[model samples]
Target: MNDKVLIVGAGAIGGFYGGLLAKAGADVSVVCRSDYDVAKHYGYRIDSYALGNWQLMPNQVLRHVSEYQGQPDYLILCTKVTADIDRVTLIRDAVAPCTTIVLIQNGVEIERELQQAFPDNLLVSGLAFICCNRNAPGEISHLAYGKLILGNLSGRQEPKTQYLRDLFLGAGIECVISEDIVASRWQKCVWNAPFNPLSVLSGGLATQAILQNQENFVRRVMREVCSIADACGHPLPADIVENHIALTRDMPPYKTSMLLDFERGHTMETEAILGNAVRAAQRQSVDCPCLESLYVLMQLLELQIRSSSLLN
Candidate 1:
């Protein structure tokens, strides 16, 4: 039987991955809100780097997770982890006892919420290291890199985890199963903690621009993240900081997801990406002055946006 994969929130990351899974012969379905009409009629138009540009119709398209039919082998939660929505509540209805829930999102200290909600369900933590965007409804633009790293949040390598890995590999996607996925989460944070917020705080500048102007600032934040990770027993590579700077330098001029969110007048992921890291630091008695400042700025900006919307 083909793997029945149900994607919640078919945005850039969701569309790109779910579309590829369909192309790889998995039974992929998506629950889309705003792009329902566009995707259902025209299918997903994906411009990918590794799989080439292609369009394919998922097995089904429903507006909400409650409408999902049958027991999905995997439920990939692709929604943005923001203050407005409860991530656990969004996909709780669609989950079954044996189902595996994969969190393809960015943030630290997120797995606890899912594990607590569905203690029996297999929990997979995923991090996407790609520069992609949803240009329009039913559209995705994959600029550079399309790699995914996954690890079981429960610390067990079940057969399902291996199956998911093999599935992505079959799709020509580079997928890695980490020995310590929590450490991988922290490693990704090193890159995210700096560039994501910097992009938003720098008046919507792209990653390249921020690196050019404030390389030291970026490194400092990354260093603090690594230190905190070490304290948390997820020590990263010593050269990881420089590696990110080099990667950003070579990548095409691109706006980060957080920056894009701010640009679209949506709530940015301040708490998940920045706030959580700072909190972890506080718990460890480690100082993260730079991340704290960015968290404060992003929080203030979000309040300003909410206030502006209320007045208008």
Candidate 2:
């Protein structure tokens, strides 16, 4: 039988990966908000530099989770980790006993809420190392790298995790299953902690520009994150910092997801991406002056955005 997958937040990352699952013959469905009318009428248009262009017509394009017809085998959550939204409340109704909840979002220490919400169901922590964005309604542009890492949060090797990896592989994308997903989250944070906020703080600079101008500052922030990760017992690889810098230097000059959100006048994931890490550093007694400074600046920026939105 085909896997029934329901995507809760079908933006760029969700839409692109959900489309790939459809390509792998999963009965994919989406619950859209902003692009509901367009996705319901037409379908998602995926333009990938690596895999080429394609369209994904979901089995259902729903307005809310309650509107779903049946229980899905997998419920993938790809929403931004922000303070304004309640991630658990968004998908609580649709979770069944057998359903495996997968979170393909950025941030460290974000898994406990979902695990507590549905203790009986299996939860998978996912990370997407890709440069993808939503150009417009129902349109996704996959600009660069598209690798996925998924692992069970409880440290159990489940077959469903492997199946999901195979699906991405079959769709021509690289997907790996990790034994320690928390460590993977920390590793990704080593890059995200530096580039994401710096992109916005630099007044909408791309990754390349930020690296070019503030390479030293970026490395300091990354090292802070590594220290926090080590203190938390999820020590990263020795060469992770250099590896991320090299990768960023080689990739196309691209705007980060945080910068894109700031440009769109939307709420950025300041708390999730930076705030959480800073708090973790505090809990571990790790000195992260650079990371803490970035967090404060972002919080002020978010306040400014909110104030501006209120005025206009």
Candidate 3:
């Protein structure tokens, strides 16, 4: 097995994958900022109720991209959606000629941006089904859902993609190579569109925000997102709203990344989540009132947060 896996953006998703791959005996090198010391000291930890595990250390860890002596077999980019687009470029030159870039971020358009730079490298889109958060510098709490869906841009299964799937499956992670990755990505977006923003706005767990009996806000937000996806030629199922409602209900009390950023006083990824859908809908001449309202409301909320921070 190709042992070298470089996981960029050592955040929740990256750490989870790195930790699991490391436990599976892959030589995992993580690229992060100054927080590398904490990860190095504690190794990487994964806490899960569904997976019935806690904090497995990786085989290896590193701070800088330059510390990687040779090219990597796979580059797992798990940076935040709102991060600079140029960070991927720094690592693009470090990969082997046939290296696969598996993006495990939230937004749908990150693969497109990456493809423009490394056109020849195999750019894969992946959807993460876990509620992972960076509790502290080195600690990560993976509440539930450790399944992964991976596919190529053409949505075709090739030898390379299969190998990657096998690697993850061997590590005891549920890995699915789907022919409908676009739909899957959009499906995850449907799940995130409401829960992420609602958590940010209402300041609560995603399950709490969506599963509460009184608030139809969650359904309304997802309805608009589904409509927008349909308009952009994806046409997600109508029950997507209900599925998310149930999925969140089954999960434990957990805060979404959006709310975490809100509490930490960081900017929320409104454009990447809701704005991308709205832009696609407009391009395809579809109406998305709910998404629009959410976008506007978030922008206002962000502005208020900024103002309050400035005053303080």
Ranking by TM-score: 2, 1, 3
Please report, as a residue range, the 10-residue window in candidate 3 with the lowest summed lDDT: 51-60
Across residues 1-312, which tens digit of lDDT does each residue of candidate 3 receive?
A: 646788988888888888777766777888876458787777666676555555645445666566777788788888767743465665765667868888887765556777887888887788888767777787788776789999887877878789878878877889999786777777888877877777776756555645675358777777777776676667777788887888777767668778887887666677778778778777878777877877788889877877888999
Best by lDDT: 2
Assess every candidate by TM-score: 0.96, 0.96, 0.88
**C-alpha-based local distance difference test score of model 1:** 0.89
Candidate 2 lDDT, 210-298, residue by residue in tens: 99988999999999999999999989999999999998899889788888888988888888878889999999899999999999999
Task: Kindly give the stretch of ten consecutive residues in candidate 2 with the minimal lDDT sum.
Answer: 264-273
Candidate 2 residue spans exceeding 4 A from truth: none
lDDT of 1 by residue, 1-312 (tens): 888999998999999999888878999999988899999899899998666899969888998888889889999998888888787888988998778999999899888988999988899999898878888999999887889998986567878888898888888889989888998989889999999988987888988888888999999999999999999988999999989899889888878888878888877888988998999999999998988898888888888887888999
lDDT of each: 0.89, 0.92, 0.75
**What local lDDT score does residue 97 receive in model 1, on the 0 to 100 scale?**
77
| Model 3 clashes, total count | 1
